[model samples]
Target: MPPSAGVDRAPRAAWQAALRGAVLAVACLASTLAAAEGQPGTSIATSVASRPAPAQAAAQPAAIAQRIMVLERQGRARPQETAAEVDAEITRVAPFSAAHRELLTVQGLMLAEAADGAAAERSALALDDWHLHPGAQEAGLAAGAALLIRATFAAHGGHDLKRADALVQEALGRLPPEVSDLDRYRFVMVHGYIKDRAGQLEEAVRLHHQALALADQLGTPWRRAEARTALAYSYFGARQLERARQLSDEALALASEATDWVGLGRAHNTAGIVLDGLGDQDGQRFHFEQAIACAVRAGSKRDEARYLANMADFYLKKGEFRTALLHAQRALPLARELRDPDSELVALANIGFAHISMQHLPLGKRFVAQAIAIDEDRGALAGAASTWLELGGYLEQAGDLRGAVAAYHKHRKLMAGVLRADEQKAILAMQEQYDAEQRNRSLALPQREQQIKAEQLHRRDLQQLLWALAGGVSLLSFGVIVALLRRVRQANRLLSASNQVLRQHGERDPLTGLANRRAFQDEMKRRAADGMLCGTVYLIDVDHFKQINDHHGHAVGDAVLVEVAQRLRATLREDDLIVRWGGEEFLVLVQAMAGDHVDALAGRMLAALEGTPVAVQSRQVAVTASIGFATFPIGPASLPVPWERAVNLVDTAMYLAKAHGRNRAYGVRLRQAANDESLQAITGALEAAAQDGRVALTLLRTEGQAKPVEVAA
Candidate 1:
């Protein structure tokens, strides 16, 4: 196949090779455990045993290390080919000793692939092995490498922090007095990524700033871009949206200069996510696509999968079910092939969601259940919370209202717990840093007293006067307190209103004003539960929406969406719900409707959308909607075997309508209750008559007219 035709698939090969190399290198290191056991306490060990160096010296590497330091200084510095590549090459030249080799192997893997889990484990083992043979000679480079790798692992996996801290401490213990300024900066840069991921955001920001300063000193484009990117990511995770966007853009510009496609993709994706939070759907989608394009250029499957899933969800929210399903289908097989459980789980959940929008309730329900099961088995708390939220929607639609409520509440509780735990960890780290600072201040107070005493006295005097006011201040204090309380109450009210708005927004397509994919799933769940009663699910699509997007600008396409949503709303009853399952797809769930009633509803909806004039860019555009409907209790044959299966039937029917011609409604029916009753009666009469009237007879009829029924003989 041509590369352009298989753009998404090409990256899979490169990503697989990288991961394989990482896995094999790690395995090789792990297998070398016995060899690592006998190394005489080497260079790093001896350095730590001597009295620990001064604070400044402990913070930097020796000047003699300048040769190696130059290579390690920047993330993107050129052979003189990026700082990371230089660092890898430098490792080969400076020291091939056992301790350095262990460090090199770990650093090599990290520089080669930052997110490889197995490589991280191997690095940890190597570090542990070095500690086992600690001596004076092992202090500088070897010790620093150990600390850097351990921190990297912890940050990636959200693993043990105590071990990370200990390793960092050991590295600091061995920093030589004459170490180069450049080398120390690189060490800090490496440390920053780990700290950021470990939830130490403030520290992460500080370290990244230091890295930026060093990158400036080195004049390394790669280092600057990486530092900027890291800063952006850290800011985003910390909820500093504006700052993240600013840094991300800078990073992308620098990455462009270097042809760093992977970095560019990461920057775009990260920025896109922030834009999404800011309620810019078009901007988000555009950036997401840019990221996907870059990832493909870079030949990165993992990145591509990430982008595809993101884009799929975006389309799903836009009420384009067909497009969303296509992306989900594409992502699932890749996720499975890659053996990425997290990706696979997300893909499964997305697939289930698409099915639900099509009114294949049974099949949709099964898919969601499988996703939930996967999350639970893996002990993925966030995944579990997400699954629970989805399950709640299903139960709610299934008419298990109580179960739905419980599930929603459970999801809330889990999310709250995760947030609280993160907060607690942050607080603890801050407290420790504060305490350490206080201790440093106390120890330095006497030495600095003469120079700072006057400044301190002035501040103290100012504070004393502020505390000296009396009765006259009482009224003012009271008034101030009352005003503050009012402000607090106002803020609380605003927050509550905001949350409610968010919840409502969650169900709406931003561009179209149509119900989103989430709403469709919720509606489907409701209809499936009404299987015992009267409810019907309809799958609807905008005929040729892709061609529309291609010909018209997305902005105009959005206007068409808004117009269609308006038409749908007007045509549907107040009791019914219409969902934008994604892009050009819509789902309609109508209650108190029999098979024919649903078909009529679908036909009316199709006519309504087709008849409406969509004004976009001052032009009137004519479009049509295709609809398919499936009803429940459809009997043994037509009824969905599972809740999600119903979604499939409606989807299949909708496509059939589209296939027949545009702007039409296609519907599938369940067997009638009347037919079932007649069949039952006939069977009973035949049995009774054959038994020679041995069975008792009962006359049950409307308006006192007799309708004979026979009991068992």
Candidate 2:
């Protein structure tokens, strides 16, 4: 992926996309604006802007340097306009003094970061070289600023920690030991990013904290907000979601107070990601919109596209296929406009998935294939892994079981690499915790030892008077210590057990205490990996479940679902996997559907609940369910049937049951004929699924006359 493609790549929070370039730009704006209010910043522009100008920039090389620095900061805050402005300024400047050249070099870095390396080669200055400039203290400070910028490009764009480390070294070396608080803060922020990219997340987080403290020392709210945002980004990369969210909230408050739109947009982006993880779909969308609005106000096209992609993800989760496609399609052109391949890949992915949801198989598959190809070509292992997973989903939905299997295999392999990378981050987190505990223990140990010595000294007199009594007391103290150790061990054991239980419950339905759809899918994959080729999947839906909720309230509806799940479990074999698929729906998976097995099983499912009424709120609520089941592979040979298609088949059959009458069961065989496997046939079926309008009319009899009722596809 590109330097800033994390949010666009998907909200696992890689600190890319809206986070990196946008954040850097916003930081520049915030710091400069704060300096306008007499708060200090590392920028030569801020220093000059706070004081006086030195004649014409042409007359004084120092004045030219300051003007260049001011233009550089402005470029970040307004990339659309200032990119060309900075380019012209750099070109117009005749001879390069060390300080003047530093501004030009930093401008190149800002461009590269913003455009994801599109502007890296445009610099006349030696971007690769980091050396001290001969002049006053301000000249050294200029070199430090340039080093930080180059280091940013190296770390984020090139992923070259070695080069970045050298740049940072020069940055630190160039600065005097008594560096300005603002300069030191900027230096620390660059180092923190280097540490983060190197997978030293703990060190990275600490460096960000140091930056925050320096920001505070400057007595600027904007600087404080920038520090909080940087820390939040680090936490996000480390997957410390709660801490990330808290820091983002704090940063947002600061940004809002300052009316810093660029900073606020970045904060909103962070908040949106956290909200997505927490499953607050509405809140996530709201923040995503705010981010886009801020991005537009900040005159940042890249940010606009990034947030649009994120909004597509939000709509995808909501099952609004058309809306998701619209957002993704909108983002694709913007990404292309910037020539950002990584963001383009993600936009393609979003569009493909939306197409799949809309059941446009062939069209969706093409976009997915393109995205995957890009990932493979770019050596984007993480992006490739996620793209393959999306491909697997598309293939499965299209009933191409063989293709889906291949995609899944590729996904699993690439995903292992992704997980391995995270292992280092996990270890760092654990080590940090262990070190903290050791520090606490070390602090207490000295005090404890002193108290023990004092007690022994006091007991010397008692020991002389009564040796046996002293021995008895010593034994009692030892006994108490042993008991305390045992209790501590027991408490640790209980905590471990509790964590284990929490993990297990994470996949189960909270209301029904049954396996959820997620758990069911996992079990299906496990069974497939074990070479279990044949099974039956039953899709059961409660008839008029909404009416039940509307009449009896959601509390009663939930209670009824729990009862229904229990009844379904009672009817199924112990080996069968019963999943609370969704509201008022359950899925049952069992091995084999030979002979009359499917009919018998479906009958048992319907009878399970129809046999008795559910007791809810002291009222006997009538319960009836529609059942649909499908056989895997269609039983001609041993060819595997796609699980997604099997689910869809059963869903349609369930719809048929509803069309006929409530409280009935239906079954379907997987389409096994050669013609059914063709693209044309699949397209037709998918088209029908997409145009799910009620074409057939069902007769509803009331007393004597029969009223026509619509039946959906």
Candidate 3:
């Protein structure tokens, strides 16, 4: 049902790791120290002991802050040593002091790095006490950093994203105005990452751009590399492969020049994802290998695990199941040792898929069940849904039809539940926004009412004082009339604006921002009224879209649709009308053109989609569309065809294209002059009409083939 289940395709879990692995490397911003300054081997105890008692007393907090920064950098490689050092520092510092809070912040970051979520949350809550004594210097900054650590871990663990977003916002708000650019950059990157995970690609891109700007301002190559890598990942999620590749390459160069191993590892991983989407299997393999090398050189077990899983996925996709199994086995221990559930899950899923590919059915199903259990424990519905689908594919491949059907049904049910939950979240968001607006209006109402009363009192006073002055009274009356007219006009403007907003919302497909059926119907009606309904209509449907949703999850499916809409806009003329005609289908209306030109345009549309694979969630998915087109003003008699009938004809042709192996276009044209009777006969059965020579059909394919078919009635 989904292309032999799992042999050739990269598992969704591996793609997710590729897309998010860099987030671990960049989460702390302390890694930038290696490039900005020097190695982080300076001992805090020695530095403090060397200072005189008086100087130590004055600069103790600053020294502790520096040590915390160094530990953050070291914690990536030597987490246990760093944790011990942090504990010693915390023991020496005064409880709840600025230095103590800073140590607590670093502790939380380490705990999060180790994937100890409960511990991290406890640390975050402990840090929240800083809010009670907000007057302390640097209290907000320490608390904010801890909150961010918790937020990042939650987001990556596939926990509550909404809560994670709120945490990020809270952290941003808590940041002091005088914080360093590096601090702000970390916050922005984390914010962008959270937004990206939440399916807000445009917003995520904007935030990443802001981080890049901050990096440029900071003048650090490592910072720039991290920002570019992050931005590249965002672009990859949006299916802009070329842009992602360029950015990832730049990040690689910058990281290499700066000797920033963490940055280099992330850059290589990002480049691998882009190369995979570009269909350069060799290039992706090389990059993934380089990513693992960089991670090992950096001594970051967390990063090593992620990169190893990615490499295993690559080998799995290439049909090297044993190689994949070995790599996944290696990654699994590292993930479990780090207590990193995200990496652990990826490793488990890859192992499962590899085992299944190797004909170890029972073992594979056991591993898959473990992965699913992890997802359920974390309440990751999206992950669970895709895993269920993958299980279904495995069952189908094993020839267990009944088991496959049941698994598929479970997958569908889980996905439907996920979609409904997302809808409820969206509705809740809208309600909150509406409530906020209402509160603002309520707050302004009293002020407005007071101003109105003041104006009326002033007018009454002026009328009484000017009772004997006729000219003054007349001027007051005119002023009142002008005010009334202004108020009426203002109300009208507000009404018009509200109506415009409503119209736009009603007529647009929210997912792709394309015109919907209502807008298309309105356009058709307008065109008919203007007697200008002469154009070619094309109906395009994405091939195997349901399978994509089943294999990749709904989020990636939505990304595919959005990318397709963008590609359509890029390929078609600006004046052409594009609409989201139906689920996984698009309709385009081009200005009247000859049959040959229409065929050429249809070919362009097919090539636009099938030319390259779309990148989504760090995986490459090949997408193609089946299109059917027809130019109106039928037969040699120039019979005016109604828009509805024209649409029906093109729909038929679209189905024919689907029937003919897809990735192609079919065009319908009248063969000769036909009366109403013949037109009805032709419309009743399009293929029959073509077979009888009542119509001529043209076929164009992306494989560079074109032909005309006709028969005598």
Candidate 4:
């Protein structure tokens, strides 16, 4: 993207539109009022009102236009106007002139109250179609204004880092090099802010450093503190909590000196997050409150909403469901009011988590489901993964084991893709930096060679040349150190690969390279933490495995287990983490599917393992396996030993399958007590129901009749 197309472009457009409207109104009024009072058309109100009664209304536009023209003059007289007055006047003239519309809208936004950013944003967007030619002052000003307004809007917009970045870049490009030094640093700081949002942490750090350097040169404390706050944001995102808090403290002290409410609010919020991470709940809460107060005093709704969401999350983490719910509810309307989708997502998710923790399953599901739906629509893969984990856990808690498993599987798949995408971006960024450095080095090669030749000629004497050789040897030794550093980096890359493999093993079965019970526990823990979507878990057991080992040789039994592992791995998605629980038992964690799919899963495993013979004592022996599966959130009653109970339930179902006929699959069911016989009967019934889709989705009755809702494509 070009510099002109960077972050903050949208807000600039709004300000431009508002400004044009103001200019038009001022010009028309000035001319008409001047005529009415028989005075030169200098002031807006007098020139417009002074026109003939029949022509007065018609002269309004003309007078406003004339005022704008005069204002553009080099020596025109004018009274000062507050930022608020300037904003109101700009809004008045927002409707006229397509060419300068965007620029005027942006100019108007520069003076708008931060609280009214949403409305101002709408005005800016209205000028999206306005374009300017190259080197046009009007165009450049509009772009710059749009960028500034956008950056301000984004500070509180939650998850819109992409849009924020584009606007900032656009604004920076439009800025003329001849502009005041302070203004230049302002643009640089905004750019740093955008980089922070974009998850380009190191880049944001570099940009902030640049901004701070400029501020130091200009001796501007105001801009310098702003840069410090921006740096803190970047550090926080990078998980450098200590550094972020330190920078935030520095920013806070400076903000107090300057009496800058916006800066102070940001500093407080940053400090609050770091404190929260450090387990200083009281300190975090206090800072959050302070942030909210400062934001409210500054009339900054965006900041207020942000702190509200932060407070809600803190409460949720503290197990204060009611308080968390209250804060989340408080933030929701404000988020909507600001038209910020990101804040909306966080508030809604927080509220949903509170409800879930409170045991309000249905209500909690609704809220979390809504968040997932919104995130999915926006193509936010990471958000969707988090929501899936939460929902899956809820379903498992509700006795829908199959549904939970499916949900977990979906979450894993999406999260893997997200991680890969981030890795790719990092790699690309590294390549770009390397390429740039190489080009710079290549460009300077000739000059460097010339300098070396001149030095060589100056040292013509043997003794002088000998001294020069000694200096050259020293430089060569330094070069060797640099080369060693490069080799160390290369070794680190190899170490990283080994570490990745080791990490993967921790989540997989040692014997079969399948997933382990610990992995399942870890996933369940994550789901519980996220507190979203309901899910189901499946505990499956191979029938009469001990008998098989007793009857057959241990080697043959081992072969059977290995074969089963291969089939399970081949049948499931890469996202589905499969693990051997123990002995003949295995667990499959899936997401987004229902209990009905469990039968299909069983059938696939059976078919994949079928007709494979094991050699025992030089003879071929075929072994048949019976599968017992149990689902949660779909059973008659909730099982407290959710994960473990799922396994036992499935074990009973497998026994039932063995009794009915060997090598068949059966589903597990809920029981009043640990009655193995009763569990088997229920499992058989559930398995039968699975065939008719009764376990997957049943038609619901609305008022006395079955109701149907068609899904929109």
- Residue range 1-713, candidate 2, lDDT tens digits: 12123343434222342223222344665475444444456443233334333333334454444455455444544554555655545443433445445545556555656644545444523433334433333555555666666777676556566688788888788776677675577678778767766665666788888998997887656557767877887776555767888998998998777666666777888788766554455777898899889878866666677778888876765668899899899989987897656567778888888887787877887887787787777666766777775566556655666556566556655654554435634644554454443333343244644554454554454334344544566655666655545554554555456445544654676679898755665686787874333588888889877456535544567778989988987888788898887767888889886736666677767777888899876889998887766676653454465565456556655644554455776565423343325412332242233234211212222213223233332
TM-scores, all models, native as reference: 0.46, 0.52, 0.61, 0.46
**Best prediction by lDDT:** 3
- lDDT, candidate 4, 1-713, per-residue tens: 00000011111111111111111134554566467434565444322233345444555455444444333210001112323333344544434342245324433343232334655565565444345444443445555766666665554333456566667777778765666554566566656655654555667777787777886786534445566766766665555668878887887887677565655776677777556544466887898889778767755555566677777766765667899899889988987986655556677877877787787867976887777777788677776886776566545555556655555555655654665535644654554454334333343244644554453444344344445555677665666555545554554555455446445644555457776655665676686654222344444556555345434433456666777787778888888767787667777767636545755665566555554665655656565666655555434554334443345445544543444444555554343443434433443344443444334222111223223211110
Tell me the spans in candidate 1 whose CA falls farther than 4 Å from its real position: 1-118, 127-138, 158-191, 194-200, 237-239, 390-403, 409-713
RMSD, model 2, all Cα superposed?
13.0
Tens-digit lDDT track for model 3 on 1-713?
12211212222222222222222333244444322223244334333234335534665555555556556555655555666667766766666786777667666765664556776667778787776774655787877887798887776554666888898888888888897776787678778877776766666777898899998997767668878987887887766778888999999998787777767887888888777666677888898899889878877777888788888877866778899899989989998987777667777887887888777878987887887788778777767777876676566655655555556555655654675535745754554454333333343244654554565565555544544444455556766655655555555555456446555755777779999776776787778874334888999999878567645645677789999999999999888999998779999998889766887788888989998899987899999998978877776778787665577567767756665556877888887887756765565466667777778878777775445433231
Candidate 4 ranges with C-alpha deviation above 4 Å: 1-179, 216-222, 390-406, 410-713
lDDT against the true structure, per candidate, is: 0.54, 0.62, 0.70, 0.54
Per-residue lDDT over 615-702 for candidate 1, one digit per residue giving the tens place of the 0 to 100 score:
7767777888767665654543432334344455456445444444456665544333324344233222322222454222221112
All models, RMSD in angstroms: 16.9, 13.0, 12.9, 19.5
The per-residue C-alpha lDDT of model 4 at residue 430 equals 53
* Model 3 per-residue lDDT at 529: 79
Tell me the RMSD of model 1 versus the true structure: 16.9
- What TM-score would you give candidate 4 relative to the actual structure? 0.46
Stretches of candidate 2 off by over 4 Å are 1-73, 77-105, 115-150, 159-176, 194-200, 236-243, 397-400, 412-713
